[model samples]
Target: MQFMILLDMTIVNVALPHIQESLGFTEAGLTWVVNGYVLMSGGLLLLGGRSADIFGRRKLLMIGVGLFAVSSVLAGAATSTGMMVAGRIGQGIAEAIAAPASLGLIALLFTDPGERTKALGAWGGITALAGTLGYVISGLLTDMASWRWIFYINIPIALLVLVLIPRMVTESKMVREKGAGLDVAGAITSTTGLFAIVYGLLQAVDHPWGSAAVVLPLGLGVALILAMLIIERRAKDPLIPLRFFANRTRSVINTASLFYMAAFISYTFMLTLFMQQVLEYSPLRTGLSWLPLGLGIGVGIGLGTAFIPKVGVKAVAAVGFAGAGVGLFLTSMIGVETTYLGGILPGMIVFGVFAGASMPAGTNAALHGVTEQDSGLASGVQTTALQVGSALGLAVLVTLALRDAMGEIQQGVDVDVAMTAGYGLALRVGAVLMVVGAVLIAALLERVDTKLRDPVAEMVQHTA
Candidate 1:
């Protein structure tokens, strides 16, 4: 279930160029293929968590899995851009329901904290593998079959999850405060605010920065987000309580987590483009090229699991962030003629190593001192942060890349070269984002110690 939910996040990326050609998507509009899924999932994740608490976990799990399977068919059969986006939106909603429920069930099953830590460690590993597998499997499917098979692949997995839920997983207990109501307003405002901001950012690539077309939506989006916060403060049963973020240490970890995810996911997005577009590697080759990264991550997660008990979580996180920042800086040096081994391979391995190291520490920090009931809610919020960060980072980096590419085009550079240059610009800035995360780690998490953890693994740990 975790694999099915997280894999969809990036499986489409390797197939993006093909999907664009097949569906005739405009360059600017292609991002919606990703954003549509992420935005809805990110927007509704908190509500989805609450829904699990109000409704039965097993019931929501089956509903979500069923919807996911049905949408996979819809996406696989899509013949137009609208149809594709609709399918993706359906997927986002399904994922919002199932992903948290699936994860929450994991926590409920592992009653012992020691055993739970090991379970979450395994969870961390699987989550990392699923992320890279999305690229590998998507590339294989696109090369050997049709890109549409990316969507087709999910049906069997979802069906299996449906079958296994009843047999292998037990229903979790539900909690409802007497007379408390859902914060429907918070959900609407946050979702619309996020959409508005993304839309404005994407549009900025084409229009002037100060254009009302760009500014109005951006302003409205910020206003709406502020409104969401206010509503959270006032709501009887807040979709996302503002108090949830009041822990200074947790707040800092999450902030750093957001930046960490922004840089980490941007690297995935940019590197895939770099290999396919500039290096002109086939999808299979491109997918295979990431094997070192996957291997490094596996190794790092193993090491961090061992090291965290000895050195403490924050120390490991600090070192991990520092290493990841350096890796991204090295990646930023890629040129049109750069070789894979020197230019791409080492950087990927380094970043992968650091990402693995940071995962457990970050997870420990996020879940430290939290009680059982709110455990699911904490996990859901962290996942939302991961998705929102990934989406926002990709949008910002794409906007910057496109703007740079436009300038290069105006200067009469070849479109392909210009595009690579644009990606390079995004990559260099992505390096800065990683470094910023490292700084936050040093300042915020270095002295903190977490003795117990409550289900902290992210899809991004990724927030895995």
Candidate 2:
């Protein structure tokens, strides 16, 4: 189930052009296909996580997957931009309900510290692998059949999950205080706030920075976010308990995740555009080209998992982010005439390896000390950070890139040159953001005892 959701994240990348052309979507409107899913999912994740604890993990997962299948059908059959965006938004809502519950189940099921660590590593690796495969599958589906097949592909996966979940997984929920209610208000405010901000950012592609169309939604989003904070403070059961931030490792990892994902998402978006639109690579070729990066990610995940017992997460994560940043910087050096083998593969491999290593380490740190009770909450926060980062990063970075491209075009730059130039600028900024995350990980993450096994074992025994 998690694989299906994560796969959706990247599968759309390879099919973006097809969807745009089929649906008569403008360049700016096309972003909504991606952002709509990410934005809603990210915004509602806190609520989704809490709901899993308050309701039931298995029940929520089943419901989410069922809805996801339905939403995919809507998206697959859509004939207009409005229907497609609506379907994607529905998919996001479904993912929000399902994703944290899936992770929460894994965290709770693997109680042993070493086992939990390995499980998390496996989870990260599988999902990362799925993200990579999404491109390949999407390419094949788009070229051989139709882009709509990408969404239709989820139906069988969802049906299988629905059929198997009841037999394989038991229901689980957190024990709550008497009279506690779901944080519906917090969920509404956060989701709407994020949507407004993303909408405002997308508007920048068409409207001036000072235009009311851009300013109003941005302002509304900010105000709503402020309201959300206040509401959470007063709510009987907040979606995101403020005290969750007290865990230094979790807090720091979550913070760094935002920056990490922001840079990474933008990097992928730009690279996809560069390959398909600028380099004229066929979807199949473009998807196959990402094979190296995917394999690198798999290798890096293994290395990260093995090294954590020796050096701890801080050092491993810092090095990973730093290396990934350098890779992005290198990739940004490409020009309009550059070939993939000579120009793109090196950076993709570098970025893939380091980025992959960082994922498991970050997950370990973020979920450290978490028990079954708050497993859903921790998972939700981690996922929320990444998704929100993805949405915001894509929104901001794409806007900046398009802005640059337009400026260059106005100055009489060649169309391809302007496009590549804009993409290059965005990728460099993404590199800087990655470096920033690395710095935060290095400085803010406290050094742990190298004997992680002994401490984790002891902690588990104490809890038991």
Candidate 2 lDDT over 1-464, as tens digits, reads: 98899788889999999899999999888889989899989998888888998899999999999989999999999999999999999999999999999988987787776787789889988887888899899889988999999999999899999999999999999877899888899999999999999999989988999999999999999999999999989888888878888878788889889989998888887899899999999999888887888888888899998998888889899999999999999999888998998899999999999999988788888787666678888889999999999999999989999999999999999999998998888889989988999998899897542212335567899999
Instruction: Kindly provide the TM-score of model 1 when superposed on the true structure, using C-alpha atoms.
Output: 0.94
Q: What TM-score does each of the candidates earn?
A: 0.94, 0.96
Per-residue CA lDDT of model 1 for 236-302, tens digit only, reads 8899778777776677777877788778777887788778877899988887887778778878888
- lDDT of predicted model 2: 0.89
Candidate 2 weakest ten by summed lDDT: 447-456
**Position 370, candidate 2: lDDT:** 69
Off by over 4 Å in 2: 447-464
lDDT for 396 (candidate 2): 93
CA lDDT, candidate 2, residue 53:
85
